[model samples]
Target: MDSQEDLKRCPVDFDHESRTHASNWPTEFRELRGKCPVAWTEKHGGYWVATRYQDVVAMAQDDATFSSFKTFDPHSGEVTGGITIPATPIPRGLPVESDRPDWNMFRTYLNRRFAPKAAEARRAKVRKYADSLLNRVIETGEIDLVNEFTGPVPAMTTMELMGLPLEEWREFADPLHEMVFTPKEAPEYPHVIAGVQWIFKRCIETFHQRKTEPLGDDLLSYFAHEKIDGRAVTEEEMLSFCNNIITGGVDTTTALTTHALVYLNEHPEDYRRLQEEPKLLPVAREEFVRFFTPIHGLARNVSRDVEMDGAKMEKGDRVYLAWSAANRDPEVFTDPETVDIARFPNRHIAFGAGMHRCIGSFMARVMFEEMMHVVMVRIPDYRTHPDRARRYTSVGTINGWVDMPTSFTPGPKIETGLVL
Candidate 1:
């Protein structure tokens, strides 16, 4: 700690992607934020960690200096870097992993489709999906909400949006859900990678099918024929685009809703308030997003030498923006740990910041809100069994639960009349 070299080397021996280090994130990140806001870590090829709120925001905003671009060779299973510490072996996550003109080019084409109005338009379908999911487990009084409810609703919604068969939501979502929390060394990791690869292949085939059929009001139809920069969109671009939507769309919202629901189960006072005052749902949703901060951190490749919070990072060095750490910063939130539903002027970057910010954020909100509404109104007395609950082994990629087992008094299904 005394030497200059140790100072830049991140004295704490930080490893953001480790399964063992996940629980100690708060304590570890607090130290880094206080002692070295831009500390460099030997983990993940020696990347800089930005913990302070303003610093993280500043870096995220300046995409030119802090790039999200990365290259991948699917055939060789080689990945240079793209938006995650120790980047995983996957194709580019679309505009999220693109820089400058490419980012703008992709984002502009899809922005209107994911805009607030578009999300609002999809509300009824989200509610229908939520109600239908609960209908499956209501009579049994036992439910693993992560799998049966939270996971499927968003997956189904995403499928419906893509003009894919709603029944195949599992086929599309299961691999993504599995790949996020599973460790790289696990035996199933290889299978998970292959499953992901299959998803791209399916997307290509689906896009081609859509090209020949009559165009519809969906993403697949648009990508099948739409031109970007006066040229036809390639299958690679289509795969990247679909990958970003499917990957980013389903699991993050599931995680947020799962955490929020579990929190509600533990804190009956908050639940009572939310139930009695239905108008507080929207505000409470934001508070949950801020507190949970799903999609916690992402990486950016340094394009040039820049000094951030007294630490100088050279060109090509990777930097991890600790959005989770920034969300809990005392300077930004009055009491960062506590979940206050009425939190005002809340500026947490749960969805991220700048040009590369999450494109499906509004849609995510709709999905979360509908699911939250359905649970509170229908399963009022549902009780989660903590002993049987399982959380993600690693929150490095996404802070979420593996499963949450719950029991409730068996109730009759409310006929929604919508055939799923």
Candidate 2:
């Protein structure tokens, strides 16, 4: 097993970002977990995939050994140590893409807004957004749930929390929705890059403006004119932090919700069960999160030479912590492929583990619950058009649907009584 050929036998053909991987990744990950828990791949400039739950958890926890720090030089086209493999050409976001002391400051700043109690307090806002979004197409009977419903609620909620104009949610969110899964060779790739650049441009401007404006109760105002590590937060760090919030905030819950919609559409019994007993939505949400794993696996950079579960990782080597695979590992989950909504004590790593774990996780849960509960009550008879449905071309970054056209018995829209 130590030989190069033995490693190759672990199959050198895996590529998470490929179109084929979009369709066959679960099967491929299953094989990898069974054969080589930590296998190498030449794809994306060669990185190791840790499919075992224990190994991924270990790597995620030991951020010192597996650094989240990254740097991108736009002029030289040099990229190093980011969450994504092949290293994104764009600037890396804060906290998640950093290590140790620098990361801790950002994390602490964000905690005030994203902590469990803070997120819980946001349920009313989330529900109001969800209701308003549904009110748009509830009477149409036919709509693209992904475009109209799931996508907008989270985006608008994020904008509201940040004290930004709610009308501009789509402008800020669409590019990110496109960039996460688009293949590099696609004609739209350059467009996506431009949009991403525009995002940073807008973020930089807003951050600078916030500094001079009167402080408010919103998250951005709190961050505005803030000092970190004994100095004002720099422009570079500001843009990076803004990028992190937008990237992580807008799309993840939508991905999970759309995926669950597609699933429940295919399985009527599960839909009926949820509709019958609304209290079970939280349990089902965890199961869906575990099953879909919207953010498939996040990338990590090896800080120093280390070996885990017999995979000898070297300094500066890139690694992918396959949360999707870990969530489905037979060793950790009984009947791994089966979907049991009531599975308690589920040690799923869907939100990841350790220090750099998703900061918006509590916020995401509140968002999902409100949306799911509303959909269940309002669109109980809804049916998705799988034949015309569109999924992400490459699911390496986000395992999600692009277009989920659904039709339901036309229902009267409720009076949401909320205004931007």
Candidate 3:
């Protein structure tokens, strides 16, 4: 096939119903990378597919040359598009889809919450919650791992971190999951959007409460009081800011936890190794995130006409940083296909890179590490129910298990008395 045809045939477009049912996505990506590193796919209504390690990495890092704000029109083939695939609609928030000074300003206020020390401070509480969830599962013998355990752990952790009422966690988590992994036209979309709106509204109300009462700890209090540009932030900005953190935090962490367990089940030897040498738990969590790449790709729009690898990309072109493809790139990672707990210099862009990198990365790392540690210590022999392994559908921007049925002999729950 000619280069243009080759680009048009790139298989990354899983948006189409036929391609959407794919069971072996990783293999498909590998095939695409080998055949055409920078191929264009007619999927997602036609967009460029960069499958190589270097291409994706460069696209992610070069914010000036590759902007992330263009909105693609599927029907017209217009490339100046939004960050989402299929050129769909979503409630806009600052920084996630913005560029430069504006993005930096918003990010600065939120970055403090996910700082390394702040994230570490939540470990004890996260571990307790993780263990408590597992305790419920251990008694059941067989549990729907995704819906029962993997999903709630992160949802609860995010709530705790945000200092929101735990009672509303399920209400928030269900809709967030639906919004990210299901089609927007689905019946669930309206409900999901409503749930998100409700959460944001509550956040706004809480901001008011915090302003008067001044709760010393938690994110809302910080945002309520924090000054930007030598003045207090506006309520709308605070709501959008909190929405960004909560929305991003809830689903991705759930996906990471689910993917990690699935990986452990698929590789029992690795699970046993982790159980034996608990010190490797942290490394294993990072490797799992890198290998699975819970969030598949992040989109960027080119701000200027740029030349990369002999190809000319025009101004306002939408460039996708394929984190999944990049994570498995052979050039950067030795045997990128294999999940090595000790993979050194393992700088994966799973959380992204540069100015737009995920602010919740440290918290995510802590949640994953603590959850994995608890699982390894308590339920060492957990295995997935092969017949019941439920892979998520319509997850264009994120990859995760929708339903994971795992069977394990839940050991006696250990009491690690650590306060939040």
Candidate 4:
């Protein structure tokens, strides 16, 4: 057993990379919660670490005090600040880093596209896409599930939702991946920035096209025409909003889908149960999000001096709402380490809480549930290639697999052709 002093310094740092890469982190986190629920560390210029479920919940809900704006230096802080982990530097004018009145306006415009009804309406299409992808994988006998199946599903779905050109899908996908996986200080930073600039330029062109030649059903058209505060949204605001949706919707969903499949493969009993009881799909999807927590944690800046969980936090201090740690906090969950699809009233913060909660959550859930349903029906006997499961390595904000190779008996091809 580690001493109290040892426990405080166990994780000592809260950067995404250290926690994700450290095999004993789960144990370290468990020990910290008991010894010092809100521990401080000097690693990333000092930040308070909240390991209890209630603390994270309170912090997430108290956005007034724990501001989400520019929290920490993404490069060296315990809490890798920014909207993401590993803290890729976002260009100025992006709405995610903005707060209050401005944030409200941007979220209002985005809400319409990601509303539950809109996502629910697309269920048929989402299911069809999943089925088609699974069919392709089955035909190949053995396949890299991440790149071959999971990656493309969300990429295609997000493109369709955003009304982006089909040809540019791959172009956008590359930058989104780099922004999440590659650290800003890495040698590839220049290349990643160039890719992001290219995509932003294309987004600008697309916004212009939508303005003149409206694609009535797409999100860009909606934003182009919608009035905020009884006035038109500026081009710059639209660009940032679009960028947020593109990156958030694409990479997060891809990581989630990849994790869901990997989790199901590792627990065949749970897989069989899900297949047998299809109605449990919704519950299972929520569990998967809770279990995998694709977006690990988000950063928040202290708006005012406040004391919390024994730590004297000053105004302007950066703090991390560790969703991964919070979700597994035994104070709120029983057997926090295990996967329980039936864990009802499971108030996990995987999608976060309060206003800034994931705008595309409904869409993500739809994609996940629909994909699970399609896979259960089409490839029920799937199994993962143990040696090829590739976990992402970076002090970043998502828990995902780079590649998940799988083997399964191919199901009979459907007579109705592929669904676009």
Task: For each of the candidates, give the backbone clash count.
Answer: 0, 0, 11, 2
Arranged by TM-score, best first: 1, 2, 4, 3
List the global CA lDDT of all models.
0.86, 0.84, 0.71, 0.72
Cα lDDT for residue 234, model 4? 79
lDDT string, candidate 2, 28-50, tens digits: 89998888899888887788989
Off by over 4 Å in 2: 1-11
Per-model TM-score versus the true fold = 0.96, 0.94, 0.87, 0.88
**Model 4, residue 372: C-alpha shift (Å):** 1.2
Residue lDDT tens for model 4, 34-55: 8877776665555667778899
Candidate 3 vs candidate 4: the TM-score winner is 4
Pick the winner on lDDT between candidates 1 and 4. Answer: 1
Cα-based RMSD of candidate 1: 2.0
lDDT of 1: 0.86
lDDT (0-100) at residue 276 of candidate 1? 94
Q: lDDT at 385 for candidate 3?
A: 73
Candidate that scores best on lDDT: 1
- lDDT: worst 10-residue window of model 1: 3-12
Give the lDDT of residue 176 in candidate 1. Answer: 80
Where does model 3 exceed 4 Å of error? 1-22, 42-45, 70-82, 410-420
Candidate 3 structure quality by residue, lDDT tens digits, 385-412: 7467656664465677667778887566
